[model samples]
Target: MKPLCLSLLIPAVLFAGATVYNAPAGVEQDKLFQVKVAGQPSFVYSLPVGGMTYFSYTSFARRADIEITVARPVETVAIRPTSYGIRPVINGNVITFRLDRTAQISVEINGDIKHPLLLFANPPESAPPKPGPSGIHYFGAGQVHNVGRITVTSGQLVYIAGGAIVRGSIFMDQARGVHILGRGVLDGSLYKKGESRMIEVNRSSDVDIEGIIVTNSKHWTVPITASDKVTLHNVKLVSDNDWDDGVDVVGSTNVTVDQCFIRTKDDCVAVKAGVQYFTKFNAQRDVSNVVIKRSVLWNGAWGNGLEIGFETRAASIRGVRFLDNDLIHVEGPEGTFSIHNGDRAVISDVIYDNCRVEDSKGLLVDFKILKSRYSKDAERGQIRNIVFRRIRVDQAEMPSILQGFDATHQVGGVVFEDVKTGGRKWTSLADAGIKATHTENVSFK
Candidate 1:
């Protein structure tokens, strides 16, 4: 399916005798456009917005058209590298406009396509940035006595030194190449209602959040969404609020979460494809290639170490590895480390290696086959190629519950090698290790 593109329409105030202009030479041939004002070709699609004109592009299927709202004057609007071939024909067409690397092209509207106009056929800018300290300059909604929230755009680098205490969620929504470094402390204990997050990095790339302490957030504490090449290293998340989750990664890829310490009331680290309520477009959401290694989880009496999928479908989580992590006092139902595939998705190729656990009262590992038995979106499939190596658990009150729904939608190819448990004799390894049923290819070596 073609991604959705917004065709910005010029407001009705700037319709002077506007001029028509065409693109310059050397523009990409694949991307094309046609600009109109009052239903006239007042400006070429390749021309920059010198004034108020409506802009339309392929939304989906190369034929569907969409328009958005824009505000820019003609004189200040300049379209560099102005020419290209005719626009493609498709429906719900969503073209990616990356900065820097993408050749310069301009769109003519009666107005500008806003500040961050989408560049058709251009790749995101990958300019070789100068070397400097890599971190986030946080402007969250908090108080030094009320030093308001900080907003940093994508591709900007700000270093946070150690021992700096700030109150609020650092907004990294539109930022790229963000780095949170040093022994910094982002205190989010007093977050207000309707705030986005303690540290939210969304739609960005090459981000690194490391060696920081995020404490006392009121909501999802540190969430990275729709981003890529992110690293969370040696970070400590202390959530005192009821809804404070440590890390919620949604629609992201190539993330490495290592050597972190978490004590929260919710799941310490949840690898999610996307949430159902907020995300509607399947093309805009996906998460993959994540690794959580050598971390410690604690204090959540009902929290999960690693959980996947909540509500929405269209998820395909692959190449995820959780290795050398330590879990302490991770409390939840028997099926806490739950892999839930709702519909139109498959959660596969996940591995957990050399993970040490402590004080797990509920089931050690549980994989849910269908979202629910009766839901219609339930495309029954197997949880394939899950491997757990050298997982040592200590002190569980009940039996570990690991099961699949049926033979067809069973937990496929679960390899549990060198798995040992220590507990009281009544609920020991022989009795409480695994209570699996309706599974296939489950072997312990």
Candidate 2:
């Protein structure tokens, strides 16, 4: 429990196939963690979380070693999303680990959850956007811009260069083929509660958002509603506030959220079929074909990690997939993977495949067809054909339930396949402590 004071300077080594970005001018560095990737300084941005949380990101074509110098002597070192099994070599105040592929992990020194450091080892990006366009809005590096609520339309590219910080929100309505790219930071701390969403996509199509850090979102971080063909790739959202849901795919279709890091106060990723979306346009009310894959998520104190509805007002909500993601910390009152079908929707064909949980304080699975504060229909709904495959948990023994309002609004055709909790593979329903009252064909395989 003693603080270790060491020189901040370490000889920089130019390791092949690695790129470490420096902090922008006037951006404060993390006092607790000085991270070096491939022997180069990876600027760790410190933010006030529970007390403080540090974040550092680097890109690698193949592999790299991450070295961290801590301010305090560590008794225990835990690198989590424990399904990765990343065991670090700790020597005094230095911790070292190797990453072979793209990963986002929490480094907890002596099991300190409140002050953990988040490391994002990312894959190499595609070629930078070619410099030739009329619809290009660029913010250069080492600068801070205050552009509040920038609007975009068709065939536009909004690029935020590395080491740039922008205090604004990207609002797109009735847009098509718009891309918001590059490695920068979008800080929304200036926006008060209910003022704005960091990236608001309403009535848009063919939109792509890639490689940016969204911090302190006033409302939902990225809310996609009445949109189609949208993709969110390698975006990091680190904002914990009231009602600050990470990625709310509401009434959207053909959307893919890939390889993102979301540590927020509300649901990390939620799918729904009802929302008012924006001011001018009429919103879509049926949701389908949404995929969220290969992301690292943490839900803090408010909602679920991966959730569907309570706002399921549409007639059909189907074809939603959550694949190969990691939920590191889910501390909420609801289920980590839940379906709260409050309205009159037939929610079906949902799949959670190869998901991992490092530390969870919520239900593993909850599929209920009932009413809540967000419901609109007087009659209840049903959940059908839900599959949870290869789920791995490394923490507390969470409970699960599949109940309904009555026999008319029951849960049906659910399968729990290859789920392991605390190193024990579930062979029976008792191993997972699931209660299926009005459920049908619930099986463990």
Q: Name the best candidate (by TM-score).
A: 2
Q: Model 2, range 301-375, lDDT digits (tens) per residue?
A: 998999998788788889999999988889887889999999888999999999998878878888788878888
lDDT of 1 by residue, 1-445 (tens): 0112323232212222221122222222122343343333422222121121122221211221223233322333323222222232222322222222212133333333322222222111122133344433542211122234556676665433332345555776656766665433466645664354777777778887765556567678777777788898767676545667788877788989876767667778887654532333332365678898877665365556677654325447778888977665555553446676555456789988888775565667767666564234546545778887777766544455556767666777877767666623332224546677676677767
Cα error, candidate 2, residue 318 (Å): 0.4
My TM-score estimates for the predictions, one after another, are: 0.62, 0.92
Alpha carbon lDDT at 327, candidate 1: 69
Which 10 consecutive residues of model 1 have the lowest summed lDDT?
49-58
- Specify the highest-lDDT model's number: 2
Q: What is the C-alpha lDDT of each candidate?
A: 0.54, 0.81
